[model samples]
Structure formats: C-alpha cells, structure tokens
Target: MSVFLAIVLLSLNVGRSGGAIKPVVTFTPNWGNILYLDDVTLTCDVPSTAPEEPRTYHWYKDKRPIPGDQQTLHIIESLGRDSGDYQCQTIGGDISDPVFLNVTERYVLLQRLPSLIYEGDPLTLRCHHHRFCKAINPKFYKDDQEIKPSGSDSTFHIPNITRSQSGRYKCTKQIQPCYTPNVQELSDESFISVKELFSPPEIKVPPSRVIEGDEMTVRCDTRLDPLRGGTKLHFAFYKDGWTVRGYDVSDTYRVPSSQLEDSGKYTCEVRTRSDTVRKRSDGLYIQIYELFSSPQIKVPPSRVIEGGEMMVRCDTRRDPLRGGTELHFAFYRDGRTVRGYDVSDTYRVPSSQLEDSGKYTCAVRMTSDTVRKMSDGIYIQIYELFSPLKIKVTPSRVIERDEMTVRCDTRLDPLRGGTELHFAFYRDGRTVRGYDVSDTYRVPSSQLENSGNYTCEVRTRSDTVRKRSDGLYIQIYELFSPPEIKVTPSRVIKGGEMTVRCDTRLDPLRGGTVLHFAFYRDGRTVRGYDVSDTYRVPSSQPEDSGNYTCEVRMRSDSVRKMSDELYIQIHELFSPPEIKVTPSRVIEGDEMTVRCDTRLDPLRGGTELHFAFCRDGRTVRGYNVSDTYRVPSSQLEDSGNYTCEVRTASDTVRKMSDGLYIQIHDYKMQNIIRLGISGFVLSAAVCFIYFHNKW
Candidate 1:
C-alpha cells in the first residue's frame, strides 16, 4: 500500500508540474520617448508553456484594463489623450511596466521694433522670455554669430553706432538636456540702420544760364537709404544759402517759368524727422536771361529774273557766349527747309524759280555747359520776273449722244516764225498723245472717255513751254425709258388658281430680235417664260400678290434694258352652296327641311350657310346651317318668309322660297264683343238723363 501511494504521488507531482504554464510577454515599441501627434505600438508576446487552448491577452493604461482583450496595443495619433502612462497585461498572467510620455511647444516672440541710429548715436535691442517662468538665459547673436551672453532681460546695447554697426540681431533662450543643449528659442530679428548726421546737402550745376520763359531744372541728391523713413525727410532749396520761393521735396526741384530774378547760386538741404541728422547737396549757380530776339535775314538783289542765280543771308545779332560764334543758316521754300549752310555770316541761293519763292530764316546758337540758347528766326523772300504761260482747248464741254471735237492751243510765239514745232498733250501727268504740228491738234470725242485737266506743251528750238487748261467735264444722258407690264385676272382667290401677263413695247433699236423678258416680285426675280414683247406668268400663288415688273434683256447677254415696277393684287374668293326645299307643296303646321350642297374641294372644310325666312322684303328669322337644316312651321308668318344662302371658298348663292301661303278660318267672337260694349254704353246714358229730369 505504501509503494502504490508513492507511485500515485509521483504521477500527481508530474501532472501538476506539466499543467503549470510559464507566461511570457514581450513589449516592442515602434519608437522610444514617443513624440506628440505620433503613432505608437506596444506589442506583447507569451513564451510557450503549452496549454490545451490559446490564451487571451489584454492591454491597459495605467494598470486599468483596456476596452478590448488584445495583446498588441495600437495608439493612433499620440495627443495629450494618449500621453499618459501606458501598460499592457495578458490573460495568461503577464504585465508590462508603465511608459510615460511628454509634450512640448515651440514658438518665437518679438520684443522691440527695428530702429535707425545716426552716427555716434547709442542703440539698444530688447527681447523677452518666449515661455513663462522658464529658467532661460537669453544669448545675443548678430548675423547668426554669438556676440554676448544676456541676463534675465535680453537686451543688447551699443555705446556708439557707425556705418559698420548696421546688421540683423536676435536673441534666443538656452535649452538643456532632454532636448539638445542650448536649443535656441529665437526672438524676432531686429534691423538697425546707421546714418550720417547733418551733412550739408550737395548742390550741382552752378552758374547755369537759361532764357526767360524757358524751363529750368536742378537736382539735389544724397546717399541715404530711403527705405529707412525716407519720406519723413524735409528738403529746402536756397539761393546762396538763403531760402528761395519753393517747397521742400525729395532730391530735385524744377522751375518751369524762369525769370531774370531767378539767376543766382542754388543749394538744397535735407533734414531728418528725428532732428538728429541732415544732409546738403553741392551748390549750383544758374543764370537767367531775357527772351531771345528773332533772327534777321538778308537777301542780295531781292528782284531777279526766273532761272537766275540769287543770294540770301540770315544772321543773329545776339550771342550768349562771345568768341567766333558759328551761326547756322537754313533756306526754306513754303515754310519747309530745303537747304542749310553752316557759315558764320551768309548763304547763297542758286537758280531761283517761282517755286523757290518763300520766307527764309536763320538761327544762332552758343556753346555753354549750363544751357543752349537759340536766337529768333529772320524772314527773307526771293522774287522772280516771269508769268505763267496760258493754254486753251477748243470745244471744252461735250454733251452725251452727240459728236464732239477737242483742240489744244497755246499763246502764239512771234519771235520764232513759221518754225517746225512739236506739240504734246497730257491729261493726268502722263502723255496721252503727241504730234508734230505747227501749234495745235484736234482730238475726237470718241477718244475722250475720261474728263480732267488737259495740259499742252509746245517745244521751240531753244526752250519748251507748257500750260494747263481748265478742267472740262463730260456728261452722259439716259435716253431709254423703263418698259411697261400688264397682267390678266387682276384678282386671285385665297386658295383658288389664277394667271398673269406682263407686256411691254419693244424698242426700235432692238426690233425683230428675240429678247429675254423676266418677271420680278418684291426684291426677288420671279421665274417666267419669255417672248419677244410679252411674258406669261401662270399658276400664281397667294405670295405673288405684290408689285411686279418686267425686264427686256438681250437673250445673248444678261446686260439689257430693265423696266419699271407694275402693281398687282390678288383677292380671296368665297363660293356658297345651293339649298333646295323638298315637296313642291306644303300644308300648315307641317315639318319642312332644306338641304345645302356645295361643289367645293373637300379639303376646304368648315364652310357655313345662313338660312333666313323672309316675308315680302322683311326677314322674319335667320340662323346658320351646316349640311342640313330643319324648321317646324304652322303659321302664315313662317310660310311667307323662307330663304337659304350657302357660303364656301369660291362663291356665295341664295335660294328663293316657292312662295307658299297657308289658308285658315276666320273667327267672329272679337267683333261681337266690340258691338255689345257699344250698345250697353248708349242705354246707360239714356237712363241717366231721364232720372235727372224727374229729380
């Protein structure tokens, strides 16, 4: 018994040892020190101490079981919500240590505005802590290079500023471990620009001369950065350093109307808004002159023969700058400078003609650094002794449809007697025709298709003279009259057919000839068959109701006589049906019916007929009828008056009644009543008279 108990205890011990599972969990994270707004994963794994079924795992936060029983924990975006301590626990009895997370913010702040310092002026830059209650000692940096360590209040001060002191400056807080050591929390960079103080503004172009009424401009510029409050600067112009009549402006001043009093030394000065700096330009001297005088012109022997040489001179008396002044002489014809001379005194005009007769002027110029002044112009004219030759044409005006002749004649030259001469005729500059005649030539009217100014030239042994005659205008007349047209069946039915004819008297010039005639309606030409004298327009439509005309054109070519318009109108036709009453004889108080029939196209639908009952000349009753009409009559009034009319697309017809009368017995009751009333009235009057006498 003891030996058997020992065996069972060994088996039990073995079973207990085998069923005890060794649970293992491995926590693997995607990252260490999880950052804000990042995803993190915590994976847990269990080592094999085999159980009969799969073991379940659960995740937890700060030792509390998560909602789902999952071994792997997934954190989507790590915010403050997911920033607390995180841990995972398994159903098989394993747990993980808590993992802590942290969040931080980064930003920048401004402590002061950018400033400008004049030369030798002190400057300062101030920066404050970016985050509250943080142990941060700000460090100063210039152009990203460490300059000095700053105290609790990050302020950088410069004792004196020069042009080299201008640069970008910033301050940053120092950070320690957990982040990079000395991590900069930068402050907004400030700019410091240095300027020079109270340098007199430079003046330019002194001793400048300008004529009165001419524009004069002077510029004053300084080397200062305008972007650093440039508009706040004030500029003043002074003549010899005393304030002149002008307002303060930037760099330049322009005096459009310069007077003689404006001649002086000018200077410009610029002042800054802070009163710490000012600049002035170099001095400029300007001289103003009076209005320039008009130039004088001189002509030698103003009177000269045509084709003879002449001399013309132009000179300017006033010279702005003395010493060998070179004057420019320009010759003009009709106000246009044709030739110019670069001479000190005079210019020669060669070979003068009537075309060379016009005003001439000359101008003198002085060479100066400040201004270039020109003297006023001088006027001169060249005269010549010659008269224009005269020309005439015979039969200047020509009438249409008549024969014409043209002759070219010039002034007779007596010096050259009976000499062989050459004559040429021109119409529009180009020679039309030429002939070797003594003096004149004749042109036929058939050759004068165009009319314009005609010119003729007669050549002698020594010279050739040409003259232009007055313009001759030629007129053409309209000799033919428009053709006349006529048509048949002037009126047309709305839907009925009709025909038309267009006729005209043929012209004698085109007699016995086959002429093509066309018909026109509206603005469009209508199609029709043509004859020598007339055209037939057939099968006309309603649209053909308008003015129609005929054209008598030559059949060989379309260009021929066209006729005037003829008016025509088409009318709508209405046809009524015929109605007849049945039974030649009728008695009183009987039913009678009339039938209406029309011989019109079936397509012309919805035609109405009017029926009336007339006695003698008066109508008793009237009504409209479609195909058939019925009437119940018993009296004589209904028997006498009865007529029916039918209307259709082309005609209207009225049917007369057979004039039947109904006979009836006459009654005497009405006459008996009238006689009895008259007898009673007489008896009453006799009785009244007797009673009155007895009383």
Candidate 2:
C-alpha cells in the first residue's frame, strides 16, 4: 500500500465562462508570512493565450473588495492587519483561486511561499525577524543537515528547484536588539514537496483497427503545468523496446505504409531538453493484418519441348473482407523479368526454347502497389536443338580507328543441320544488330566508347530453339590523355604579365588529329575555342587573380576534357597608407605633426614613394618625399577632418588614408595667467621695501 501527499488547492467559488480561462495569483520574495515592516508583492499571472495588451485586474481579500485594480499588489511595509486571503480577477476572464498570507510579530521565523511549488521553479527560504530585532549570521538546514551556515544573507535561494530537494527545512540565527544582549533562536521546520512539472506521456493512435497497406500515425501526449507553458519539451517514439524516432519537437510518428512486420508493442517518451525530468509512456500493443496471402506460380506443362507453346500463372488469395480489391501479377525467369504487371494473372510464352529454361517465379500486388509478395520459384527444362553459343572478338586489344568484328559460335544437332538460324548482336544489354542470317557484327572504326561486354543470340527462322552466347570483353585505347592547366610564372604580382596554358599529349599514331582549346576563369568562358592553347593577360591586376581552367576538344566535340582549376593570387606592391598625429590631443599654440604610414614589399625595396597631406578634402601640402607634415603654430581653425595619401613614383599604385579629426584649443587663458603672476611679483616687492623703511 502507498500513501500520497495532499496539496492544498484553492477552491473556486464562481464558474468561468466558456470564452475565459482561469488566471493564477502568485507573490514574490516567496515567504508565506513575514514580520512587520517587511515587503511583499502579489501578481496576477494569466495564460500566454491572453491578448497581448494591457488589461484591468480586480483584487479581493477574504471575499471582500480590495483597493487595487492593477495586475500586481505591492506592500512596502507589511503589518498584522494586512494578513488575509488574496484573490484576483481579470476583465473578461475567470476569477483566480485564493492564496493565504500571514503576518506575525514573532522574534524569528522561517517561511516559504504559500503557492504550490513545481519542478524547475525557483525556491527561496527567508529567515525573517521582527523589525526591532536584527538577524545576524543566519544558518539554514534541511532534514537535520546543514546546507548553509554562517551567512549574513537572510534567505537561501535555489535557482532551479528539483523534486529531490523536497524535505523538512528550518533556519537558525542570532538576534540582537538595541540595549539587549544577542540571543540564539531557531525557526519551526517546514516540509517542502516539489510537484511534477508535467504529467507522464501516453501513446495515442487511431481508434480503428490497424491493417497492412494502410497509413498509420502514433502520437505522444502529455499535459504541462499551465504556469510553465513556455517550457520546451521533446518527444520520441519506440517499437518493441527499440527506438523508432529520435527526440524532436514533433510529438507524432507516421508510417506511410504499414506492414505486418510493423505489428509490435510500441512506447513513447517525453522529456525536457535538459533531461532534468524524463518520462516514458506505457507499452501499447498493435496488430497489423495482411490484406492478401503470398502468391504461387502454376505451370501447366510437365515437360517443356522446343517450339512448343507454354503458359505460367500467378495465384494468390485476398482477404475475404477485401474481396472487391483488384490485384496485379507479374512473372520472372532466372531473376529476369519476362512479363510486367497486368490485370491478367497468366503469362504466355508463344514458343518455348532452350534459352527460356531456368528458375521461374511470380508476384502479386494490389492496385495501389502498396502490398506485394513473391512466390517460390520452380525450374523448367527445355530440350535443346543446338549447343550453347559463344561470342569471339577479333583483335581483342583494339585502339582508335581499328577494325573490330564479333562472331557467334555454336554447333547445331546433326539431324537439324539444315534448319535456318538467325543471329542478333547486343552490347551492354542493348541491341546493336537485328535478327538476320549473318552471324558476325563488324565495326569499320572502333573508338574507346565502342568497347564493352558483347554477346550474340541465335534462333531458328520460326523464333524457337533460341540460344545466347557468353559475354566477351573488348578493349580500345584513347587517342589522347586528359588536359591539364599550367600557369606561367605561378607567383604573379599586381601590374605584371600572366599566361595560362592547356597541355595534353596525343598518341603518336593519331598525331594528325586536330584539337581546339578554350580558356575559362572562375567557370565563365574568357576565350572561345581557337588554335592557340594559351591565354595571356598583358597587364594583370588584382581582379585578374582567380581560379583558371582550360578545355581541349576534338573538332566535333566527340571527345572533350577540362583541366583542373589553378588558383592565382596577385601580390600587392604596397599596403594602404594610414595617417597618424604626433600628439593625439592638440591644443592652440602647440606644434603639431602628422605622418603617413605604409609598408612596401621587400621585393620592391628600391621603389620610391611620395606622400601628400590634405584637410577637409583639399590638399594642404603637395606630394613630397617626406612622409610627415608639421604645423608651427596650431589654431582653433585646424580642427577638421585630415587625411594623407601615398603614391609610387610612377603614380600607378596610389592609396589614401581614412580621415582623422584634429581639434585645437584657445591660447587666451594662458596669456592672462602669465600677466597676473608678473603683476603680483612687482606689488609684493614694493610692499616689502615700504615695511622695512617704516620699521
């Protein structure tokens, strides 16, 4: 037997309208009761579905009207008279349950919020005392174990509360009063129980019985606390104790086509993203019934003879409940399709031959093609009129422009030597020559693509006693290798020449073949096909640097190859210049200096550079060898945006610095101070002489 703890629920007095959801009332500083002069705040919490605008709130105490109409009721100085049952109501919404508040004048007390506590909620334990008594070095304990001790803070707080924190809690502290000795005091123990944030998840499915070939969906359902509606939750689905769907925000798992093997015990799980609280639903058994049974192949002939007609049928039984459903059938021989799906279950072979002698099977499927099954195979042997054929290739190692020939070889029965036979040639399962009296296939000029697995078929003029030859492999070598891209002077600098070449080697035997080349940069065509194999940039700039590739192709484009990309980076001659001031802070009457800073590549060490200074976009000093500009006497008008420019001797690589603001201060204050000091020195000297003479 198990005993459950009871939660103190707030009883409702009035029924809510269908359009309204009940609101909740909560408080801050979570102390159930506090001493006189302590602060407490009460709030009205509504569901997220509420309109996103300000609303009017009505308050009541112990079934009586209160003075506040706002969402929150704040009490700065709590008094004994303020203790009562608090309730709130919002306009167009239901009235909230009532919460009790107790105010006492006790010397010391440990209190928690009077509202319900749920997992993931924050908990605060306050050790309160009378206003006149000062609490010092308060200590908190849970189940006789010291959790917090020797602290000046009057409260112990847990940011995220868990169910494991449930226990009896108390606080002890030293209290000191004016003109009285300090005394130790202990608070009454209060039990705390953290309720679940959400109920356990349960699996849900369609009410109808599940059947094979039908679509099915399973859902994991759980109810979360209304106050924590914004909390994130994850759901997962499982079958036969194995995971079917990993955790995701979606709570549903759908099966597009349910099968008999899908029938098993299924369960679903739900958890918060943090895995702090997890729950699994109870197992649910699901049964899927088949719509039809497996099919069987029926052959009429006990022994198949050459040139004789034969027929094969696929048989299957549908569920009695689905008697009106239509099914399709197909037939196969030696794992090769002989007949495609059709409403008729029978497959007819106009004339049985030795080539048709092999394992045979059949299949049945519904019109929707969702439910399908195959039948066991059966073997049928046909009397042969000729030995199996074999294909022989001439010049097994062939190159481009080489003449190739394939011949079908077979031996006919001596008694049937006069029978007329037709031959057909196939390459890679595609017909290359139709049935005719010829037994050889000839290619005047063989290329790389002409090489493949070749086979030949032989049959009598009436189309019976057919036989096929084994595959023969033919090889043809390429006329040229793939092209490659090469860059001239790979490491290029800005304002330098660059060239890209497409290179390839042609076979000595095919040296007379003509080839054209094209150039591309960053996948865009820069030059069309031409006899030249190189692309040149006389004066390459930074923009010319990119991924370059080239293509080589024959006159008819029958053979084309693109070279691998080559990345080219252009190095700058020098970095951009920056303006710097000698004294970051400038004032009137002070000499100010500005310098242009830039760095040139070591390779260009002897390059000459010139600098110029500007104020407000207008050049103040012409370009010169010196990088610095000096102002002998600064004035307030010097305060403006200043910039500098650096350029090469040829003025080809020019760069400018961003603007810098310089401000100058007034010089009148310094002059006045200097005059006043001189006047005071003269007056003091005259007064000293007059006093000495009088004495």
Candidate 3:
C-alpha cells in the first residue's frame, strides 16, 4: 500500500496523501534560488508517533532516483548543477511533492527563505552577491518598487505573509570590487507565490436525507499541507449562521434524535489554534423528514348509515426508510377521548345511530412517544341505511346471441361489507330472477322476446330497507342474416374438385364477430365446425352424391341456422372393372383367356383407359392397351386364381376385378403310364436282388 501510494502521488502530482503520511521537504537556508557556491541544507520532515530510531530515506531529483539515505541532505557550496526538482520519501511512508531549486552564476541574486510560501508564514529575503565582492549597501525591491531602505544588511524579513505580498522581487547592492566593472550590482527579479495554508472547509452529512428520530452526524472537511502538520486546527459548527458548537478539536457534530424543525442551512468554521488561519465552509441545506405522517380520521363511507355498523380509521404513513417502526393511535370526539392509544388504527361501533354524528379527530405517535401529532377535527353526518337504487345494464344495446347482464346499483356503507343483500330482477313488470344474494341477472343468450323494460329491487337479508330501481328498456337486434350453402361450379362431376361455402350477411354493428361453419351430407356431419366458411372435396365420387347442407352459427353455438338441403348428383366418369373368363370349363388341351371388363361413362368417352393382369397377386402383364391374358396351353401349373385391373390414362381412376379360379384337367392315360413305370422299376429291383443272392 505504501509503495502504491508513493507511485500514485508521484504520477498524479497529488497534493494530499490518502494513506501513509507523506514526508515534507524543507531547506535549512530556506531560499532555494541562490547565487553559485552558496551552502544549503535540505531536510525531510516526517510526522510520527513512534520513538526516534534508524530509518531509511530515499531522495529524487527531477523525478529520477538520487543518492541520499539520510533525513537531511546538505549541499556544500551549491553549484549550477544542483538546480533541479527535489523530492524525498521514507520507508513505509508516502513521497512528498517536488520542490524546485534555482542556481545562477550572476554578480548578484535575490532569494527568499522557504521557497514555498503560504499565508500566515514568516518570509525572509536576501540580497546576495559573489563572495569576492564586499557589498557597500543593499536594498530590496518588489514589483520594481523600492520596499526596503538602503542598508548594510543583505537580508529583509516579513513577520507574517499574505497573498497580497506575492510579486516579483529583486535586490540592488554596491560592491567594492565588481567583476562586471559596474559600481551598482543588481540581482535578477524572481517571482514569489503565496499559497493557502489549508483548503476551504466543506460541510458533509452522510445519508444526506435524514428522517425524524434518526441519529444524524455532520462533518467538516478541509486539507492542510503536510509541511504544516504541526499547526493545530480547531473546528466549530453553526446552524443558519448561529453557533451550535464552540471551537473544538473534533470536526464532527452529532444529533441523537433529529426532528423536522432541525432542517436548515448548516456550516462549519475551521481555524488554527492561534486563531490565525480561519476558514468557514459554505452553507449546506439539510431537511429532516417525519418518521410518520400526522394521523387523519377517515370514515370508509361518505355518509354514515343509521342502524349500521360504523368503523373509523386513523390513517397515517410512515417514512419508507423506517417501514418496520410501530405506531400507536387514539381517537377523539368533540375534543374528548373516545378511544385510548392502541396498536390498532381503527375505532368501531357495532351499531351506529344518528346520535353518533360528531366532530372526530385522531392522534398518532411512536411507541416511545418521542413525537406525537393530532389531526384536525372532521364533522361526520349520518343518514338512512342506503342510497337510492339505480338500474344498470351492460351493453345497453343488446344483440341476439350475446350474453347480457343487468345489475341493481346502490350504495351501502362499507362498514356493512359482510352483510348479505338480496336482489330481484323484473322484465315488463314480471319477475325474471327471484330475490337472491346476487345483485345482477344474466342472460346467456338474449332473443327478441327478452327485450323489454327491466327493473331490479335490492333489500337486506331480513327484507328490511328495500329499494327499487327505475325501469330500463332494452332492445335486442339481429346479429346476422340467415346463412345459405353456396357450391362452386353449380354442377359437380365425379373425379373433380368441389367446394361448398356457407353464406351469411352479418350486421355491420356486429363486425369482427367470429362465426363457425360446418358441412353435412345426408344428415351426417361431413366436416366439423371451424372458422373457415368453406369446405372442399379434393375428388368427388358417386358416393359423395347426397343431400348436402351447411350450418353457420356464432362461436358460442347460439343462433345457429342450417341451409336448405340441395341434391347433388355426381355423374360417373367410369365404372369399376370386373374380371371375365373365356372357356370357363378348361380341358387339358383347351386355351384359356381372362379379361378386365369395364365400361366408361358415355359423358367421358374421350378418357383413355389402361389395363393390367395379375395371377394370384403377381403381375403377369403391366398396364397397356390390352386388358386380356391368355394361356396358350392349359396345364395344372397354370391353374391358379387370376385378377384384372383397369385405370384411366392419367391413372386418376383405378379399380381391380374380383379373383376367378381356373382348374386344368390332366390326361388320364399319362397318369396311368407314370404309375406303370414306377411298378416296373420296383419289380426289376426285386428281380436283381434275387439273382445276386442265388449267384
């Protein structure tokens, strides 16, 4: 940390040290600017509480490391080479800021002690010349104006220095023997700067925003040069320019329990123990917030209802910073205590009467009663149990197929929040919904007949305090027109695409209402209800020919309509193929032929047809113009089931014929010959075996 601090100070040229104390460099002869061959001593002053002991020191010139390990560096007969910026540091301490020294080889030179001058510091100036010359007389001049009378002494001093005393200064002297061959020796003018002893003090308050009853601490901040560390400083605090604390070594003032009235401008004064250097911080404004706001008497109901339960609440807000603080409340009536302090913020009356009306007030305070506040009185008026009832209808313009709700509106004291109220609805002076705990009557789907003058009555559970609302007239409008089925391409043909659309005219006022459509054929659902208004059949067949109808309705399935049935006939494009066999009874040498017989509709005569033949599920011939398969020679191996298939040239219409069985009869003479051969071979084998045994 010490090494880091030294590096930071040197790199940033920082004036104040934040960590370890920084060493201060002071010259023994004080004046840094001098004539050649002048002897001077530089000392490194470090503040410490430890006993004196051998300590290591480092020195630098012009930011470069130099050779110096002692606390003091003495320059014997300083020469021009000695002129440069000097800095020093000690082990485990911060490095000091650089101080510049100037050396000139002139006949005369003007210098000031304590190269760095500050307000309230003593200052000394010397009119110097070469040692070989003896000065006859010397005088000091500031800003080219004579400041000191001619005298034999070469030194001039000021008891205390101020900023106004800073300017260019030079000295004039008469030497007995001058190297320049001039009688009067004049020193070059040098600039002097007077710096402040300490920066201005600033008032600081942590957690700038403070709440009442919270501890607050105020601080005064200022910086004094380390070179002036020995100077003692005293601090004093003020509020609105009035002294709150007298001079003291401490720079902080604390308040144990802050209050709202304590909010004001605050400032602090810093001065040297000798009362020489004084500085006051600028005024800072501070505001103390209330721990909890003043209590206010609040009645839930605008008008208190007679014979009803009444509840009064003392409402107050606490500072968010002190959210967990507990508070006590009290209630007053006509300047008399109606309820003593309690943790609860409310005062309740089981049954309120007209006599309960009076001026009410509430008081609140913290648990310790360190701060207490009361609200201004409020006058409460009590009246009947309820306000006049009024009827309200949602969506005043009711539409068919829309849900409607009618409510009996009335105001009841909130104190009776749990009290059960019964409500009844009427239509055209006839009761629609009987009295119940509900205050509203709802209609799932309204029709034209439901449109009439509607009214409602509200009453307490015991039938007491009944109020009737004025009648409200409602008119239900048709939501949409009847829907009809629309088929594209008026005439539908087999093997062709067909589309059925449901058509309806929705009321403009009911635009954006979602409707679902469904398609049916022969009284059976062909398509389920969906948002689409059209249903499509990719390819129509004879089976698709039926009494078709479409349905349209609201998403709620309310007010549904079905289109009139329409007869749709799909003209056949082609008939299913059938298998035909020639020479049904097969003989051993008879030739057999199978054919796929199919008839195309006359209306589609231009459509080309292709056929294929299969024997027991195996293709005997691929699709071609020939639809017949022939067996040139009838044999038992060729006696199997055969099938035929036919399709249009585009392969859109395909059909297969039923299987047909064929049986081939083998010649009886051939079978008998095969049996005779087998018997002869067996007989020969037996004869051979007998002959071999005899031999």
lDDT of 3 by residue, 118-170 (tens): 77766778888887777767888899899997988888888677778888888
Q: Estimate candidate 1's alpha-carbon lDDT, on a 0 to 1 scale.
A: 0.52
Q: Which stretches of candidate 1 lie over 4 Å from their true place?
A: 1-294, 300-306, 318-321, 331-337, 344-347, 357-361, 366-384, 393-454, 458-695
- Please report how far candidate 1 places residue 475 from its true position, in Å: 16
Instruction: Give the clashing residue pairs of candidate 2, or none.
Output: none
lDDT (0-100) at residue 371 of candidate 1?
Answer: 28
lDDT at 428, model 3: 94
Q: Scored by Cα lDDT, where does model 2 land?
A: 0.82
Clashing pairs in 3: none
lDDT measured at residue 462 in model 1 versus the true structure, 0 to 100: 36
lDDT of 2 by residue, 167-285 (tens): 99988878776458857664656799998888889888883677678888898999887655656789999999999999998989888898888889999999887776788999998
Model 2 poorest 10 in a row by lDDT: 1-10
The TM-score obtained by model 2 is 0.48
Name the better of 2 and 3 by lDDT.
2
TM-score preference between candidates 1 and 3, better one: 3
Clashes of 2: 0
TM-scores of the candidates in the order shown = 0.24, 0.48, 0.40
